[model samples]
Each structure stands twice: as C-alpha cells, then as structure tokens.
Target: MVPVRDELFARLERFYDAIPRDGAHTEAFGGLVLFVRDGAGWPFYARPRLDATEPASAADVADVRRRQRELGLPEAFEWVHENNPELLAVARSAGLSVLEAPLMVLDPTALPSVTELSDVPVRLLDPAAPTFGADLAARRAVAAVGFAAPGTAVGGAGPAARDTALVELPLDALAEEQCRTESGHRISALAELPGQGAVASGMAMRVDDAAEIAGIATLPSARRRGLGAAITAALARRLLADGVDLVFLSAGSTEIARVYLRVGFRRVGTACIAEPA
Candidate 1:
C-alpha cells in the first residue's frame, strides 16, 4: 500500500535518481541516503524524509548510531523526519533534538511578476563556485534572521571552510546559478543538476527520486524585487520541461513559503529535523 506522503517523496526520490552524482559525497545509512557536496565541508545534508513504519526504539537508535560510526558522519549531523511519534522518541533517545519545520510548495503558473527584475540579473556561473565558502559567507550577513538561512542551521554555512573540506570527497557533477544586482554583486545563488555539455545523467549515480535543490539564497540588497521568485520559477520550469513532475525543497520561513505558494507548488507535508547536540 502507498503510505501517506509517499507520492511527494517518491517524486523526490525519482528526481534524485535522475540527476548525476559524480561530484558530491554520499553515505548510505540503513535505507536513508545522505548527500553532501565535497567542497562545502557540511552545509547541506539530504535524506528521504518520511513516516516510519516501525516506532523508533532503542534498537533502531543503536542501529543508526552504528551506521553513523561506520559511515564516518558526525553524530551531530544525524537527523530524522517522520510522522511516527515513536520515531521522534527514538531520535531523542539517540541525543537528537527536533526543530519545527514546514514544507512549502508553489504552482509554476501562479508565480508573481518578475519583470521588476530590471536591476537584478541572474546568470549561470561557470566552474561552479564551491558551495561552502566565499559564496555562502557573502549571504550570511543579509540572510533572514531565522528563515531563508542556509549553511550551519540547515547546513549551508561557511562557504570557504566547507568547500575546502569537500575538495577531496567524491561529489556529483553540479550546476550553479547566481542572483546578481546590476552593480555586479551576487546576492543569492543556487546549485542544481550540472548542465555541462552532454554528460550522461545515469553515470552521475543520480537517485531515482531525488533532485536536490541545494544552496538557494538571495543577497540582502536584492530582496523584495522578485529575484528569488523568478529564479525559482525558472528552475521549476526547466525541470518540468526536462520531464520532472515534482520538485522538493525545504523552506526556513513563511515568507519564503509565500513565494513558493505563489509559484504552483503545494505542500505535501512538513519535513522535521532532529539534530544531535
């Protein structure tokens, strides 16, 4: 039987598989898949967020802990999102704490007007900048207080530091985009499936339902001008044309949620995060 929220996640899983994975770090723990960019020490960590079949118990925690040790992931980086209350209990038992998170969506058709983007321009970046270094540091000062924040909080922190750490790790091939003002300052940026000249996506080890929308951010000076909404819509449109039906992304606030809702995406559910202290 199809579990509740499975279709949404199934779409994500399929998208994940569709993309190439030759440039990022990956670790499999149980049935959970954790992906990280090599250049950014540890800014983003993605796994299949879903409800658990069995209640998280001591044994489950122990098993996860063992998996972590074997995979070399920091205990602090471990997290879980599930509708099963028992799963939350299991995470607590394993020293993880839950944070309130909301999943937001938007329909591509309803996306607001972006013609106001006269001052700001978005362009694809070449030799894609490392995700966890200078590019990320550039936004911390401007990012929203608790929301629209990437790095560290949701793992998109320290562009330089994380990028260095990811230098040697095996990472999936990546594509990058930057939100820049007319003055030539990049305010926000994003990384998606690399669109390098003719590379086989299957060789990229792309997961079947996982097209990770990584490092989405906008600069302080570029806010309120519809840059974010425009870029997001552009990405969504591209993906849909490429034959992707559903896209998955996590939001840090209602404001960001509003932008997404204006676009054509609908919420399937919440993606809760539990981090180890």
Candidate 2:
C-alpha cells in the first residue's frame, strides 16, 4: 500500500534535515538546504525544503552551486520527486543531470533474514578486529568496482576483484566517504566467501526512528548469487531489530530494486539525485 504522501514525505524531510547534524552542517539558500561537510564523516548534498510552500527556483540552485564551488565540494543536489517536482526541473535548468532512484521502505513484517551465502556467514564489520584495515580497504574497493560495473548482474569479479583493488585501496579509505565507526548513527556489515574475503558490503545510517541502508554492493563475480541483497537485508534487519521505526533505501535501478523487493522493500517514492553534467 502507498503511504500517505504528506506524512511519508514529512517523515523523510525530518530524516533528511536531521541526518547531517552528525557530521555536516546545513546552510539555507532560499528553499534549498545544503549539507556542508565539516572536515570529516560523510559529505552530504543539497536537498529541497519540502515543507516550504514555494518550490526551489533556478536561482536558488545557482546559489547553492556557487557556494559548493567556493567550498570545493561536489555541486550535487538530491530530493524526493513528490516533495517538489519542479525542483528537478530547477536542477535541469541549472544544467545538472538527474538520476531517479526507486525510493523504498521495508515491510517490517515481511522482512526476511539472510544469514549466509554458500556457508559464509554475514557479519558486521568490526572496527577493532585484526582485519579491520584490510576489510575497510577491501570494502571500499569492492564498492568502487561494484558501482563502476553497475547493476546487480553477476560477472567474474569476486574476492579476486577486491584483492586486486586492495593493492592500492589505502587503509585510510574511510576518508573518501562516510565513517563506519559502528556508533548510533552509522553501522557497516560484510559477508565473506571462502578464499575470497568481504564479497559483499553495506552500511546503515540512523536518524532517530528512521534508518537508511546505503552503499550496498556485491563484487562483480558475486552478482546474481544474492550477495548484494543479502548484505542489504542483513543491514535493514539489524536496524529494525534495534528499534528503528522506518528502514529505507534508494535503489539504483529497477533491476536492483527487484533484488531489494525480494527482501521485502516496497517502492514508496522516487529519490531524485542531481549531479554535474
């Protein structure tokens, strides 16, 4: 069933506005909100102020882009299509290409538990473990390759793929993106195959009752074997088990969304991501 549009969007609005408080600060430019990185953690992007009566204008988009240039940040913007459809047009008018991701929320009652793959159990990434450094580097590499390869289609890439990436995937790889400190706000999980290590990886970010499962990816060779969705399920199940009221994610494509659907996530909205042309 579709959720009440206003209620759902409002909940998401609060989730968006509150999430950056942990590692970034929000700056207002007319009807837009830019989450500026403060030297650490995740680098957030600009989003629409859905609660505002008037939609974001082209000038508002230009102003945010100017500030991003001044600060040396990626001139990126994101928002839910239903929140203010015009904002996507605004972003386009400002000449940024937009990606429409399938926004989904888990059906808690229908959520499934995926504990392992081919006997390799899924485990949360331990920052204090002996392999933490290698695992972090490997996870980053896998995600990089997985995203580069795109979609959930299985290929020949696996641990061999990640190991090759680990050759140069520095231990300080966390600096490139968000943190994985396993605190209240952020948590990461990984699954390992025999010989191959950390074949799949994902992270969950919490903001009060809401949690977003993101960066879920599988090694290219490991695709079609259910590893990506397994990692995604493990992360979502963990958050819901920990008392989060809503667990959601943005699927890169319908193929990926179908993988998530089998994990009990139902499409609720379209997450519009605006990036440089």
Candidate 3:
C-alpha cells in the first residue's frame, strides 16, 4: 500500500491548487501560485503549485506579499510543510509569522459514535432543496459569527451575540458560500435551538477521491457541546459514503486538533499558514 503520508500530500497539492478556480484565479510567481479573487468575497492565499518540486524563493514570497498589498488583499500563504518543506524558511525570511498547525487525515474505519443530536440537528445543505433559499443566508451568517471570536472556548456570547453579528455578515459571504457549493462541495449546518436557525456549520470540498473538511465552527454560545465535531463527522461520513478515499483538514491549534481526534482524524503532517508580521 502507498504510504498515507505520501498519498495525503500528493492528493492535497492537486486539491489546493484547483480549489481557487471557482471564485478566484491563479497568478504564478516563481514556484508559487497566488489565488487571487476575481471580485469581492473571501480572499484566498498563495501556495506551491501542484508541479512544484523545488521550494519557491524568498523573492517569490516577497513578490506575492507585495502583490497582495498592491491589490489590497491579506498577505496570506498556506502550504503543506511536508510537500514543500523549504517554503517555511522562505516565508519566515519574508518577515511573516508562520503558524504550524496539525495537518490531519481522517481514518474512515474508526469514526466516532455520533449519538443523535436531536436538539441541535445537523444536516447537509443541498442547493437543490426547496428550503435552500430560506436557509442559505442564516447558515452562512452563522459562520461569520462563529469565526469572529475564533476557537472552542465558550463565554457569555451565544444567540444574542449571533444576532448582533447577523447584520454585519456581508452578502459576500453568502455569495462565497454559494460559489464553494457550486464547485462540488457539501455544506452542513447545525441548529442547536429550535426557533432560531443554524448555529454551527462546516463544508467538505471534494474532487474525485480527495476531500478536505473546512470552515468547521460553532457559535461561542454553542461551544463545548460537540457541535464542531458533529459537523465535521457528518461531512466526513458524507464524503466517505460517497466514495472519497482521502479526507483531511488543518486544525487552528493543537488544542483544537484534539476535538477532531475524537472523530478519528490523526495528524499526518504540518499545515503551514503564513501571514503578515
């Protein structure tokens, strides 16, 4: 059998390289491919191209960062360290803070026991569903609320906090979410309260047998209730059931990676994310 590490990075390069095609286009800078957004929406980052063997130069990283500043975009870069180990030094040399997150891959056969979350029902969002029109905005807004505070640590914030954030959630988020779904991804949302809409959500981006679970978040009010894990496991099971062989994600931190570990994902490598210093 091919090594899981090898299989993971090989598939990831292709997945990451191709993901920008939907709402963004790629601009080549040496061995790097910068995912530049076509218009207003969530901005993408730079990465080593699929065919990249040698590490991109520090000049390439600086050039990309300069281009980002010119375009009024964030100086962000993401890469699987094992796939292009030398890029880490290049990014640091460019005066960027590189956070090495746990690069995890799911073991399909060992997924956790998902007890029925009746109170906070989680389900995959379908563009074809009749109720999709009514559901899309709220679910997309939940992500903005969840990500604003970041992490699993809960506080007094909850439903009302989400309500305050709803007005600030841009229409661009909905458009971006739509673009991702149209690009062959499956989005899942969880509604912890009956009267309100979704409070936790995530998506699985798939191409052939490779899928990456991302944007998994639960509202500050709803944290520590296993909502993030539920959304993750739901998306993972959905992808595997549909024949995806490799499912992976990059955790925000080591503590957060433990949440995914409950759902049978193990760290296979490091996911390097670099941003402005």
Residue pairs clashing, model 2: 157-221
Q: Report the Cα lDDT for candidate 3.
A: 0.78
Q: Write the per-residue lDDT of candidate 1 for residues 142-209, one digit (tens) a residue.
A: 23321233322233333333223222222321223122221122223332223311100000111332
Q: Estimate each model's TM-score.
A: 0.55, 0.89, 0.89
> Residue by residue across 1-277, what tens digits does model 3's lDDT show?
2235666678888888877787798888888989998877669999887766666999888889889999889999999899888989888888999999998888877786456422466777776676664466556667778878877898666667666665433566655666666656655555556765677877777877788898887878778878888888888877877888888899999999999889889888999999987
RMSD of each: 9.9, 2.9, 2.7
Comparing candidate 1 with candidate 2, which one achieves the higher lDDT?
A: 2
- Please estimate how well model 1 matches the true structure, expressed as its whole-model Cα lDDT: 0.42
Q: Provide the lDDT at 67 for model 2.
A: 96
Provide backbone clash counts, one per model: 53, 1, 0
Q: What is the alpha-carbon RMSD of candidate 3 to the true structure? A: 2.7
Residue runs of model 1 more than 4 Å from their true location after superposition:
1-6, 13-56, 66-72, 76-85, 116-119, 126-210
- Model 2, span 1-277: residue lDDT tens: 3356688888887887787766677888889989887764447899876456677899889999999999888998988887778887778888999999999988887777785422447787776676766676777778877887898677877776677776544334453333436456777778788777778888888888789999988888877777877888788878877889788899998888998888889999999999889
For all candidates in order, the CA lDDT equals: 0.42, 0.79, 0.78
